[model samples]
Target: MLSDLLMLAAAVVAGRDIVVKAVRARTVGIDLLVSVAAVGAVIIGNFWEAAAVTFLFAIGHALEAATLNKTRSALAELVAVAPDTAVVLRDGEQREVPAAQVRMGEIVLVKNGAKVPVDGQVVAGTGAVDEASITGESIPVEKAKSDAVFAGTVSRGGFLQVLATGIGADTTLARIIHRVEEAQDAKARTQTFIDRFSKWYTPGVMMLALVAGLLSGDVVLALTLLVIGCPGALVISIPVAIVAGIGRAARDGILIKGGEYLETSAKISAVAVDKTGTLTEGRPELTDVVVLDPALDRTELLRWAAAAEAGSEHPLARPILDTARAEGVAPVGVPGTVTPVPGKGIVSDVGGRRVLIGNPALLEQYGVTDDAGAAEAARGLAAEGKTPMIVAVGRTVAGVVAVADRVRADAARMVARLHSAGVEKVVMLTGDTRLVAESIGRAAGIDEVRASLLPEDKLDAVSELQREGHTVAMVGDGVNDAPALATADIGVAMGAAGSAVAVETADIALMGDNLLKLPESISLAKRTVNVMRQNISIALITVVLLLGGVFAGGVTMSAGMLVHEASVLVVIVNAMRLMRRTQGSTATPRSRWSPARPREAVDA
Candidate 1:
């Protein structure tokens, strides 16, 4: 084995003409130092010693590659978004072009089977597009003229003529991919440590080798010490561990926004959460309806309101249309023009009468708001944990229907489970109003609530928590949530049921929509960190102990190699434990009391 290794080193030197030049350049790298050690082994007639050094290096390198492949593969999910081609009307001739070259403002002809080329409005045709991959809604949404369409979404049945508004990097899908790349490139604590240590540690070992050679007048002894002090395992261990943790996280459908998450998740003390969307299912449902006009039954009023809202875009419109369709009511014919009031609802003429389906603010603006006598009932429903959207026809209150997205069944149990796993803070962050935020927070066992925030507000909320010297994790799933996700110490994207931008921007992604899985991911990361630290510590300790033994004058090169290999095996086995995550896990909670303000989870 020693003779074979010497031959291999000779072959490498003869094959690489640049090796001599690099050595002459005075840059004594790890490879160069190892090469000198191999030469020294040959001088001492211990050819096996030279071979053992290179063999250990090769094994360390192979293990590093395997671990990186296993851990850094989360970004492969973007391959599914590859758009083949687009049909565009160029100079009145509809021709196909690769999606990469498709430009903004081009009239692209999207057929039933084609994915939308870019983010834009449907200026020419109507079709329902499956935005679930980007929005996690699961249902195909209808899009027509003036309705927004996203790049990479599939057209379900009808052809669409999309006037491309956002193309290339500006498209939503591209934005997500770009963010993911950025996060992956961002440095983590473990990587930073290796970089800082390598700068000074490498040169110090070289100087030590020179001193030893001068004192002993034996180049072989100094070379052996240099080989033993390569720090190869330490350099590779941290990154291998990080990528492994991240890869396992991706397999579970969690996108970690960046390296920062690993650090923050380990340190968070107290947790606060937003109620709606975070603790409860974001989809609103029609729970109850009150009919003010005896002439109009619950079904008729619902049908009219849904028809009016159909032309208007809002999440609450789904429950109305779903209920109306299930009850067999014919929809009011859509009008040519419809106007929406921000706080109120939408107003459109339906069935030849002026229809006003909105809250009091909309009616009051027109000086025709009505009490409708359902306020008291709505308030009672609110206390019982239901959200109510008011509906009125003209100035007279027609009805107030209670709509609520139920709290997730797994929430309370998951919170308790994480607590048991030693996560001191269990938080929920949501964009719902105070009433809605509190209702879900109490039921889900969240420590606190931060409510009524728009996109910027949500980012600020996370920033404030950070300024107070707390590590924070922000989880969300919309375009509006992107900033907060970027700003948080750790941004966990709800991947499987989350928006593309959300997943791409997040430092970590959750493949499972159940919020319970977040604790699971955090646990996995912490374990990986622990294993990597262990691997590094063991390797360094073994090198020190063995090298000291060799200088004490009784150690053989073959025996030293055996000790190094043993340490290497221990490191690899320790890293493997990260594959199994606890049912729920998170950071240790500290005794340092941060203020417990009952702030609502604000929207980003």
Candidate 2:
């Protein structure tokens, strides 16, 4: 920059009638304009104005570049964690190999502190892994054999042989990188304003310079006019603000992928929250137990259902197994045959009797929906967002287990804050039944509820809402929530234990588990956006004032440039003030959301 400015100074001293430098240096921003204007100044010997104009533009560019450079460090950090090779296990022997060369079913050994090189299943070892770089959790997670691991995660302990099912760009880390890059490139409202401003400003300045040249017999005046209207500083105002906003958010536990989400978040008319993980603790507890028959005790039913569920992998299964474990009720181990019915439930053998553990679909198969009591229990469970697991012996239902996701302590107040920030609607969406979704919705002060949606169907809901011309923000925390997150106008991911693929895929992510940050983030964005519009107005007004005085004296080319530079500084300073305001009133969190209210609500 210094070199460019000095070159402009040298070019100016050469005077208007004698130009000799190549086109390369002449195309280098304000320096080129300053160089031509400076030559005019020297030919006319207005040296002070020529040098000052060049100096102001150089400084503006420097500051603009500085503000936008924050993203480079994060990108660099990501690259540094990216592994270059893998330890491929072939024929029971581990061999050093390139990550890309490792095909499907290849086993790779990853040790502590080493990044997992591919998306694969852990075939051996029990160790804790830190996926926080991806999940934004501060705690390292325990991983065991048969557990899935993604690339770029740090194995905190133990040595593992991971069987590679996904490699290269197909890895979870790769997808995250791709999503982050895409979000970065996505245009923000503020960027559009700057683009539009520059597109017209440049041409308008050129025309103004021509008019000045026609009116003034001196060509130097026109050249000076061109120097006065350089759009360099004005072009960078909002981008610098956005870059800084993203950087500050990263520090506070939010990863804003692009300026668009940041800008849109400031204007969200309605916030559609995912109840299970967005506004709640998401970890459901085994809270209710009902026996279907007086002959079967509750403990026996829970034990058998847990035994059957031991082989099943589902979030709902954990509470049943965990409750059985806690009650000292040993699960029945006599499992000769077990078959998991897809999307319905699990059927297995217990002490020579077939036990079915699942929802209503499973009950209907056995002609066991015979009593009003059983149907009512299922209905009651659905009402509270609890999935009822029925444990049956022969064709008779023996026991029922009910579970509910715990809600965050701060969710209700957060909704109120969002409402205060201009959110017109607060809706809750969940795959849990209508009763559960509605129950959780009312607890969190949500105005509406959409429940029992499949993952793809959730995307359709977002599309339907967008078609209504509403700017929507979807907050979610599950891997199942990814498609909807991608489909929403703005996707906000809960960063903690939420899936890495989901977090990476989201436009914005809450880094810590504190969900109240959602409202805070929206508020901060609103203030910054408003400040940006104000700055542009101020900048354009300054341009108008400077142009009006261009020929009438007191507004030399250098003087106009100085005022423009000052205006740029003023805007940058104003935008930086947002970083100091609390995103809400506290720190940050990225954990899941779950409803924790009682089975029924109390009128306040």
Candidate 3:
């Protein structure tokens, strides 16, 4: 009698919430199945069976909650880094205030080793910031005037007076946190199907158990069926994997939009990149100035080029102006009038004479003969990987000036890593001439180069790759690349912290400018998808084996519960592995972005 009372007490205590939920919902669930089975066991005078079933189910629920929280640790860590207070300059005095209370455009002071309280631009002083919280890189990056600094990052050294651009929820850290939360909650395709299957599968199990109990007069068998019919592991299999995978990527500064995007990213077979900023420095420098006229020298040619480009806003104009000023031949003033010719170059009126600086096509358009072989000279420079421009004074060809943008040190390694990550093709699309594009392409180990493309042409290139049955990921950081980015299967934005559009719109936004993160993101996606598949298999196999054992006559109510709970725990444990950093995820600062040594120099 005492043992039966103890069993009754345990069943009521452990199964109270489960019974209450089933009553309130007026629907069947795993909770209802477990509750009814425990009640039936007690009615049948199986006191020990009743107590053990309820106790094990309760214990399993507790363990699942605890382990699932561990999988979301990445997001928890990010939330912990948000700054609570800030030091701001108010009326020429330093004051401490809540980070969110600081007004926009306020000048916030960050001391050495202090956490930056707002996203802003550094206006004074210098420092080394440990941006691991933002970029997931452990190295300290040096900061200076005009450099962007994010909130929740620590200043490793020096002090800074920053102009606040973003505060409170407007900051990048806040956006990342919000994005991660949404991604974790979003369901994957496989998960949706599993959910639909469970909706009917649970009721079907109860009906099958009832029919078997009535047909064979076996009450013990019916009780065991309800205990094992919970579908605990199978229902949660895909969701746990997705949460862990998305959370893991967040810690590494890669934000996947949602589970749908993760599945797509895993299938990325082709990568398309923009040439200007994706592969090169994007900053061009004047390298050579050849004077075609025997009467003029290098200085004279540079001076004319600078004079025409004086009033221009073109990217190539800055290098010419900077070089001319350094050589003490800066243009006295802006050109009187500057007219730009699309796809060609600029036509400017400098000193009451028409100065044309453009490609050979531009000279031909204006009916200017290429005297002194200026066009041929420009072609020679282009062959050497320089962007050459022909300079003309009225109808006579003046000279050729060449500018070159240096290829990023990690360009080749990034391409090679993409291939290793299973990308079959790495293509570069640019508006540069074929010669200039091929030069950088060879240096970067690019498999395909599509040159002299307009913005629409870039979109067409992505479409062409898609028609060839390739899943393409477009990597770029320019306004012109927006259409192509949207057209590709996955849009990757590098150095996205500063671009609000990229952060919000990209399929995967890599917070840092590290070239290696591109391949890392792809590899991570693949691993995550594999985990999802493995988890599904484990859940399904466990269910099938437990059902077979119960009918085959050795499995009891308590034993089946134990095995079901164990399978759920195993799935959660497998997902947690994604939280750990994989091999090659990081490298020493010296090996990152540093120029490669020449072949001859290395041999020596």
Candidate 4:
């Protein structure tokens, strides 16, 4: 009687929630199946079996909950770092207030070891900020006036006065937390299919259990089938993998929009990148100034170029103006009217003379014949990967000035890593001349180049790749790339931490300027998809094995429950693998071009 009472107490304590859910919810689920199985076992006087099954299941439930929380540890850490208070300057005095209470445009003071309380630009002082909370980079970045600082990052040393531009929920950290939570809850395509499968699968299991008992008159067999037929592992298979994968990426500052994006990213075959910012520094510097007319010296040619460019806001204008300023021939008189020719260059009216600086097309548009071989000189500079701008003075060919943007150091490594991650083509799409684009492409190991393209042409280039049966990802940081980004299978925004638009709009947002995160995101998605598949397979196989064993011989209700719980734990453990970073995730891949093997080695 004592033993029976102990068994009854264990069933009540461990199985109460299951019974309540089954009765109160009016829905059939794993809870219902487990409740019915335990009740049946008790009615048949198998008290120990009832006690053992519920107890083991309760233990497994505790373990699963703990392990699942471990998978979300990265996101939890992010949430914990959110700033709670701010030190703001009010009426020339520092005041402490709730972080959210600080008004926009308020001056906030950040001291050493304090969390930056708002996203803003540094207006005074200097410091090294540990932006690891925001960018996932461990090294502290030096901050000064005009440099942007994000909330939730710590000031490693020194002090700073920040002008609050984004506060409270408007900050980057808040956006990241919200995105991660939504991504975790959003279902993948495979998860959706599994959900529909489980809708009928649970009831089918109960029906099979009932029929088996009725045909064979085996009460023990029916109870055992229900205990093992919960579908616990199968239902959680995809979600666990997605949560872990996304959380892992968030830790590394790579934000995937959702599970659907994660799936599509795994299949990316082509990556279309904008050449200006994505591949090169986007800061053009005047490299050469060749005088075509005998009357003009090198300084005279620069005077005309800088005179027109000084009134323009083009990226190429800065380098020319800077070079001229350093040479003591900066344009003293601003142009009366500066007209920008899209995809060509600039036409400016300076001191009552028409000063045209552009490509061959601009010269032709004005019917200016290049008798001085200005076009040929421009071509020679362009072939060397420089953007050559021909200067014309009142229809007279003046000279050719070339500007070049330095290529990023990690660009070639990024391309090699993309190949290692299974991307077949890395294409450069730009409005720069074909020769300049080709030069950049060869240096960066890009497979294709689409140059001299207008913004619309970029959209068409992405479409062309898609039409060729390629799953494309367009990477860029400008408005011109917007159409192509929207049309591609995935839109990746580089250095997205500074732009709210990029953070919200991109399919994959790399918070840091680091080029390596692109391929890391792809490889991670592939690993996550593989883990989901493996989990589903494990769940199905365990169910099949348990079913066969229950009928073939010695599988009791207790044994079936034990095996069912074990399989669920295994799936969770497999998903936990994503939370750990691998060495290859950041390592640069070796050059893809290898020497041909000997004939005997090829045969072998």
lDDT of 4: 0.86
Clashes of 1: 37
* Per-residue alpha-carbon lDDT of candidate 3 for residues 332-361, written as tens digits (9 for 90 to 100): 988999998877788999999999988878
Expressed as tens digits, the lDDT of each residue in 1-604 for candidate 2 is 6665565564454332223332354333434555566656656655566566656656665675564554444444555667888888788787888777888888789998888888888888888777655554457777888877777778889898888887887776666555555554566776887787676767677777878788777676787677767665566567656755654455344667778878888878877777765666767788888887878787877777777777665677777788888999757553777787765677887668787877667778767654536657767776775666666778777767778776677889888998988888877776666777777787888888887777787788777778877788888764667787777878887643225554555667765566676776787677767876776777677667776777666677767777777777777776666556463545433343343322221010
Off by over 4 Å in 1: 1-27, 44-187, 216-220, 257-261, 268-278, 292-311, 335-339, 346-372, 417-431, 496-500, 580-604
**TM-scores, in order shown?**
0.70, 0.74, 0.95, 0.95
Pick by TM-score: 2 or 4, better one:
4
Model 1 CA lDDT for position 435? 67
Candidates by lDDT, descending order = 4, 3, 2, 1
Q: What are the lDDT figures for the candidates, one per model?
A: 0.64, 0.68, 0.86, 0.86
Which has the higher lDDT value, candidate number 1 or candidate number 4?
Answer: 4
lDDT of 1 at 65: 59
Clashes of each: 37, 20, 0, 0
List, residue by residue over 260-374, the lDDT tens digit for candidate 4: 9999999999999988767876666789999999999999999999999989876678888999999999988689999988656778999999988887778889989989988
Query: In candidate 3, which residue ranges exceed 4 Å CA deviation?
Result: 24-27, 587-604
Q: Backbone clash tally for model 4?
A: 0
Local lDDT at 111 for model 3: 96
Cand. 2 Cα-lDDT: 0.68
Stretches off by above 4 angstroms in model 2 are 1-22, 25-29, 59-193, 196-200, 218-220, 339-346, 359-364, 369-372, 381-385, 477-479, 496-500, 581-585, 588-604
